[model samples]
Target: MPPIQLVVFDMAGTTVTDQHEVERCFTEAAAQTSLPVSPERILAVQGMGKRQVFQMLWAEQLGEQHPELERHVNTSYAAFRHILETHYQTQGASPTEGCLDTFAYLHKRGIAIALTTGFYRAVTDIILEKLGWLDGLNEQHVGTSDSLIQASVASDEVAEGRPAPLLIERAMHLLGVTDPKAVVNVGDTPSDLLSGQAAGVRLNLGVVNGTHSLDQLQPHPHDQLLASLAELPAVLEAL
Candidate 1:
């Protein structure tokens, strides 16, 4: 063991396979407030912050109809929150394939585990409750930094979201991490790969059990790629 301090995990795709419900909730909510026509467009904007995702989805639905789509976005996000509370948060979602054993191995070894997501407080709570791992989260270790300075987004965790390292940096700080290069970032999307890259972490493990396939994830190939988290231990041992 090299004394890995924190194993930072991505909330949605990394920890749980709830993208289907998550996407549907957003699309439905946005639609209720006059937006989107298809799930494919929303999927294309995957890995972005909720607000931007909503804006993009709504913009696509409107299709150059409104010069200012903020109002519709705002309404949709609100409705999205409601939908999440009812459907997504209530029903919950499944964890990524092999996530449990991998996490258990780390935690059992006294390695710290942290979850970072682009989701907001309320909706994320539903997810946490569903996973029953909310108790493991250290509120202080969470990151919602970029949105703090970028006020136009209307969310403290929406500014740069995943693709930026801000969230990872914030998580490391809260975890009392000293060496940035020692951390490991595991995610299911290219955005997460980009974020881990920005954090300067020496290891970034990408899994194909979520958003992208080998062909899509290859452009931003991770340090290691596997079918699922089950391959993580071997990857770590090799590291």
Candidate 2:
């Protein structure tokens, strides 16, 4: 209602191209650590914090009271971080189709851009740096209106990740956006849409070209579902 002051986007699957490299890393780490979780299970928690996913899977497999649960979770998560960091560092990351164009469209209209992700701060920085999206942000990851993006919130920065409104709320805080109705949440996972719904954003959007398909996302609560970021400008205009 307030002209969409801020648009909070999920990084890996929404703005950035994932290519399932993240899932492959998770699978490799689980195998190496003997975590005993299936790829399907990992895929199911795609938009959750990486460490949280390990803890959940390990707890599911070993029972919450198991003495070795913490050890197993720690080992698996450490391995995941190492593998994921190396892969992103070596392979690099690119923006999703039309992501930059969408950003520019918002920029020209004086709307803020905030990128929230299930990734921890380190890997999030790596990916943003590679994409040149980190140019204007300070150490705290909050940038000015002149920056490419006005804010970024990593899962590590919050008490909880997707399916929780903390990341979106945190971004709103950083960007000085007060009304949920003035925000648009865009991501490529079910958790992404759920978080947006929880945050009470005006538009909770699911993009099909990322981690999940239309059928996969159809059951989730969202205001609209999009093919990709390419269609975002028109959607925003129609609002």
Candidate 3:
């Protein structure tokens, strides 16, 4: 059997943990600030970078001119970040089941495991450090969480991110993986699914372990679906 080359990931729902508390956190912040961000609004931006979430909510709820929304989101997000940093290491933000085992197995098989989140470097590093998730990873080899940043990469690198293939392309290049047929992308969000599809990766598997329901996630043409990352190894074995 041929080996899987690179297994790329989206961090929040893919590796960090689940969102049961996250909504509560958002709700608490919204009530405190009296902003328009609701639990569902927060859910819409679950896999996004923290700042991006703020920006999205700002635009949708407050408009581009409202710096107050930015302030509110930052302050609110800071509150959440503090809590997460304290507890997320051991508890995880909502890491999918079996993700650790699958990632470990991929490493053992010499399949490069790469990750990208919507986070900025500081936030990304904090989560990785707190969770000890980046313990064995090489900083140079890992892709930075620069998804929403302009000037993030050179034009030759990738086309776009999420629903676009740019981030995966960058990860593949950094890992020296050239074959689209030998790679897979595992994620819990539809954005991840569409990103894989855009990158032309060999497999794009969706997991219901994140905020999105299967019905909403099903329209994107995923190659496979599972209830959790726990099913990943067996799925790979079958593949």
Candidate 4:
């Protein structure tokens, strides 16, 4: 097998510690906007962009062409943003177990790390800044020379979010990774797995320590499913 050149990771649930805070935000926003979205329905779309999630849910509730659809989407999305931002600001952000160590291990092997997220740039920056991961970032190139992750791509930067390969493709381009077969994509959602699979990456891994369980991720398209990010190093070494 060819050596992996880049590892693309999902932000919130994969690398960052998310205790369903995002889902809670979505649920609360939906309730506030009278969108009538169920918790199960919200969790089902965990890896999609925030605004898109609202748009989709609202479209389902009120037909896509409904005159009020756009207004409801905007209202719910704004509420979600405010709620989410406040939660992160007060609750703080932390990396998941073994996430930093895994990053260190990859860095030692001269592999590039790129973080992709369903979040827009503002919220993404908040999380990065809270974790102090943005300290050494190079504004011109958008990655850091001495940071754990080499680059980051947000949903706002691309035309589409997860389940689409655009995020992975954008990360590869920014990180100077030319071969899709030499890339590994890891996340905790079905959309994350689909994105990697669509990108034709060598390894599409799902870690079951975040938003989804093994059962939840089992039905998705993935090469391997591990207990957590802690097991990634061994998996890569064995490759």
Candidate 5:
């Protein structure tokens, strides 16, 4: 087996601490904007880009060609951004259990680490800054080996979000990784696993400790399902 050169991780539920606050924020924003989307609907799209989530929802509710589709998408997305930004800013965020240890282990092994997120640039930066992970990244969100992480790719930066391979591909491009076989993709959602599989990565891993439970993720195609990020090092070692 080829050695893993990079590990692309999902933010929010995978690496960061999330207590369903994101879902609450989305629901509140939808209500405030009169989008009338259900909490179940919002939860279903957890790993997708925020704007695209609104776009999908509004298109479903108002019809793809509805005259007010764009307007509704814009209105609801703006509200969601505000609500999510405020929640993260005031309530703050932290690394999930074993997240830092995983980072350290990867660093010692010379495996590059990149963060891919459903969030746009602004909110992504806010969370990274709060965690002090933004220090070495340049304007493009790419950092050197000396930095905390090698790269940060926000969904807005790519042409598509989860379930699309662009985000993972972008991270590979930024990190000078040439083969999907040399990569490992880790996240807590089905879309995350789907994206990795689409990218043809070596491992498409899911962790159950986030927003999704084991039952929710079992049906999705993945190389393995972990209990949490804590088990990742052992898995990697045996690989």
Candidate 6:
């Protein structure tokens, strides 16, 4: 097997500490917009793009051909963005347990690290800035050239988000990694696993420290399911 040249991580659940705040934000936004969405429904689509989530929920509630579907989606999504941004800005962001250690481990081995998120660029930036992960990022690509992480790909930067290969493929492109088999993709959601699988990454790992538990993610296709990112280095070493 080829050595892992790059490791792509998910932002909210995989590397960052998310206390279900994202789901809360989504639910609050839907209520603010007079859209009734169940908490279970919101959690089911955790890793999807914020706008796409709204679109899907609205489509389900009002039908795909509803004349006002686009308007409702736009309104709810805008509200979601505001709520989410304010939540991160005020509540602050923190790295998941052992996430920094994992980054250091990969850095010491000359492996490139990248972050991909279902968030748009603005909120993504706010969280990275809070975590001080943007210290050496390139303004042009909005990724690091010399920092521990090489790239940060937001859902807004790609043509599509999770469950689509675009985000992973874009991260690989930005990091100058050409071979999919030389990559490892890790996240905490089913969409993250699906994205990695679609990208043909060598390792499609699901970490249980974020949005989903081991049992929740067990139904998804992944090479391995980890208790947390702390176990990642060991798994990589074994592979």
lDDT, model 1, position 4: 65
Residue 204 displacement in candidate 3 (angstroms):
1.0
* Residue 33 Cα positional deviation in candidate 3, in Å, after optimal superposition: 3.4
In model 3, the clashing pairs are: 16-95, 17-94, 17-95, 18-94, 49-118
Clashes of each: 0, 0, 5, 0, 0, 0
Q: Candidate 2 or 4, higher lDDT?
A: 2
Q: What is residue 165's positional error in candidate 1, in angstroms?
A: 0.9
Candidate closest to the true structure, highest lDDT = 5
lDDT of 6 by residue, 86-142 (tens): 999999999999899999999888889999999999999999999999878887444
* Least accurate 10 contiguous residues by lDDT in model 6: 139-148
Local error of candidate 2 at residue 171 (angstroms): 0.3
Following a full C-alpha superposition, what root-mean-square deviation does model 2 have from the true structure? 0.7
lDDT by residue (tens digit), candidate 3, 149-207: 11112212333345567777777777677887788887777777877888788889888
Provide the lDDT at 230 for model 3: 81
Q: Tens-digit lDDT track for model 2 on 89-187?
A: 999999999999999999999999999999999999999998999999998899988999999999999999888999999999987889999999999
Instruction: Name the Cα RMSD for model 1.
Output: 5.8
lDDT of 5 by residue, 99-173 (tens): 999999999999999999999999999999999999999999999999999999999999989899999999999
Model 4, global lDDT: 0.90
TM-scores, each model vs. reference: 0.82, 0.98, 0.74, 0.97, 0.99, 0.97
Deviating ranges (above 4 Å) for candidate 3: 1-3, 65-80, 86-95, 141-163
lDDT of each: 0.68, 0.93, 0.65, 0.90, 0.94, 0.91
Candidate 2 vs candidate 6, lDDT winner: 2
Which sections of candidate 6 miss by over 4 Å? 142-145
